[model samples]
Target: MTATAAFEAWAAQHHIDAPHIAIKQTQHAGTGLFAKQAIVTHTEPLLRIPNDMLITTKNATHLHLTEEFRNTIYQLFDGTDEMHLEGKNERLFLKLFLVHERFVHANDSFWKPYMDVLPSLAFFQENHVLFKNYAEHLAGTTLSVSISAKQRALQNELATLQEKACGWLDQITLEQWFWADATFWSRVVSLDEENEAVDNGQATHLALVPFFDFANHSLTPNVRWQRDSQDNSFLLMPFEDATIGAHDELFISYGAKSNQELLFLHGFTLSNNPEPLRLRLPVTPFLAGPSQPAISRFLQQNAMEPFVAFGYSHDSAPSSSSQVLPDFPIAHQLFASTGFTYPSIVLMYLLALDEDDGLRIDEQENIVLGNKQVDAMDGVAEYTSQLEHFKVIQLRVILLLLDALTYHHGELSQSIPETTHPSALTNHIAAYRLEEKHSFECAIDALALLREELLQEPVVIQYMSSQEQQ
Candidate 1:
């Protein structure tokens, strides 16, 4: 039977009598759901999947298997077989592995029809191959390291499972296991309140819903879904009047995800993702200066990390909130208004310093520890007395950030040559980099403007200080 016929048969077995949507192959988006008839806005559910039909870890536990097989699966699930992955992730991998094994090896396996329609592992493997082959092209990129870490974790899990499966060891290849992992990564849905109760909260409940996974993503989605508490089924409906005519594809919003997230998780990048790109800078280096010991102690006492992330939105102002900082209202308001965090932290550190310690410029134009200047304020109260010190710290922090941004911009520019010819792979990489470069440029411009504003503040502070003295 053809793949569509196989899927139809599978749907029929599950009592899905009449689906309003049909699966169609697209050149760019793989398989997606298309409307079979005109769907009105807020129409009744397009599809309802029964609870028993859903494949989840809770349901998978009920499958009858030999004690040895169960033991091996349990070992893999606990990560006692390996040390890196979490127990929850191991359980997920175990479920998918069992599903794939039963589908391929057992004629009596109930999940066979469902498995037959899934896109081959090679379909998803191509993207992984691209990442491996073009590693250098993606150097200095935030996503490259993340992808590498995932790949490593996947390989470790697969190897652990292979070592334990003595009897069925030769039945599956690592490639097939990789495919199973990808299947979980792409299609698994998180359980809502109703479904969570069924799992007793022992583990995170996730399931694979047949036919429902075919709806492609859109930044602006027309479809909405709800989990039925009575029957434990999921109901999909149109949020707005379905402008989708017969044969038009139906789209669902995957939430407001960044382009990088969409690319890695869904294997596609949005041309116009409105979310900002985040750049992380390590605070450890900054903490190494002599006067920063107290700052480090403060961070440790508060259980904060030595890193700060700057989010650069193409169309909005840069955001300065650090996940590491405590959320006191006054500090939060100040940080948000300034549109930067590191500078404020630096300013706070400077204010905390004893008057005996002073800041001096080094040969490299970097701030360094220097001999005490008697003119420096002597105490916390005195520091606050001259509010001009706040502007001084802000100016210094802006200059430091500008230098860092310039370095990153230069690195990204030099990595890709101007005259390189394009291929299919190159085109894909170029698109990803274009978004990254755009974000960097936007951040640079925003920072430059902020520097100008901050420069004027110091003059004002000095004038105000002189006026106060008079």
Candidate 2:
């Protein structure tokens, strides 16, 4: 058998779905990683990335050096430059590595001379800074660890990146503007509280996992797991209950739909060849700013604890005669805001109900059933459809906000907090951990406007009048 064929066979045995690439038999940039297919809202896609693909900080560095970074080293150092190495492998590795940006480099002694010469090119040049700073131990010796092929330099972290990006933005003149900076903030909006926590130790640990790398970002994903060996790691699987189509892009999202497939999909689909046909999962297009919140933390903190007394557990309680308690101002305000508010409120309740228990669909029509205890598919549909009535009202409010914000501040609409649920959510004490959320100035303005509009209602007027008389 040919050498590549032999390798392919071995890779297949080792559980590589795309054995051709593993065996170095072919390159797959043209084929792409996914295919076209119809996928249900929750379903599993075959795992293309095996656990083996999970490059560690040490191994990743080694791969960076050996896999393809050789040329840059050879050109920059081997000749009269600085690193005068005489070996064949040294020349070949350096030559190959220059072409491959993703190569993992591991030789500190070898890189030291090159670093001494090329001090200003990149950080960690002379002192073996790469391994000395990022990694604790490699081969039982201290080694510079690359987090993954993606972050070879170990420079970017979600929190730190946000800080640096924002700082840079603040320095820019008013005429200078960039959307990429704003996009980073969106990722910040979705970060878990722990990921962004300040008190957490290990300053350089918050690695940003690429969203497209995982390919799925749902509120409730199908798979769930924690790695048996890796510290601070978890695995995801698709939900067993959801059906996946042939060409859909499968993603591991935040959803805990089933114990079987740790998967999450919004407008999700399953497909055999998903790269070309995967459905567009629900992602807010807006640049995540202060207006957008880290919702997972927000929901966890605000959701009523099962056993806690509703009126007394929180400080903002109201009298018995009150239709809505002060503590539940958001709940009270929902119905009064616009024509769509009622149905939107219903959908929120329905999603909460399904999420609280286990959500299931009817065996026949795939109709969503709430709490195996209650078959409320028709009710859900009615509420979901009624939301359509608010389309005009929603568009108008958005137009008003945009027009107002634009006239007030000579820029196009920066963000629309009032249109979203997370921004509208009050009683958000958790968001102020350590310091108040710096991302919510626009959202706060939106809420103040909403509250002002609500206060004009006759019900609020009557409520205030009665309180004044008493």
Task: Give the whole-model CA lDDT for all candidates, comma-separated.
Answer: 0.58, 0.28
Runs off by more than 4 Å, candidate 1: 40-42, 61-69, 77-109, 128-131, 156-178, 193-203, 284-305, 317-388, 417-428, 458-470
Per-residue lDDT tens digits of candidate 2, residues 190-263?
11232231111222212222212323343444333233244333233346765546544343443222110111
Task: Compose the digit string of candidate 1's lDDT tens values, residues 1-470.
Answer: 78778877778777764478788897676788888888765657777877666665555443334455555556655534322323375455445445444444446555566666666665665554323545666666666766777778877766776775655644666566656765665666656432121221243556667787777888777776677768767777777655768888878766666666666666677767776555555555555554466555544544655555555444454444322233434422333423344434444444334433355434433333443222321232234334435555545555666676677777777787443654444456667777777656655666677677765775746855775899
lDDT of 2: 0.28
What is the lDDT, from 0 to 100, of the residue 384 in candidate 2?
34
TM-score of each: 0.73, 0.26
Highest-TM-score candidate: 1
Name model 2 segments beyond 4 Å from true.
1-45, 48-52, 58-236, 254-410, 413-470
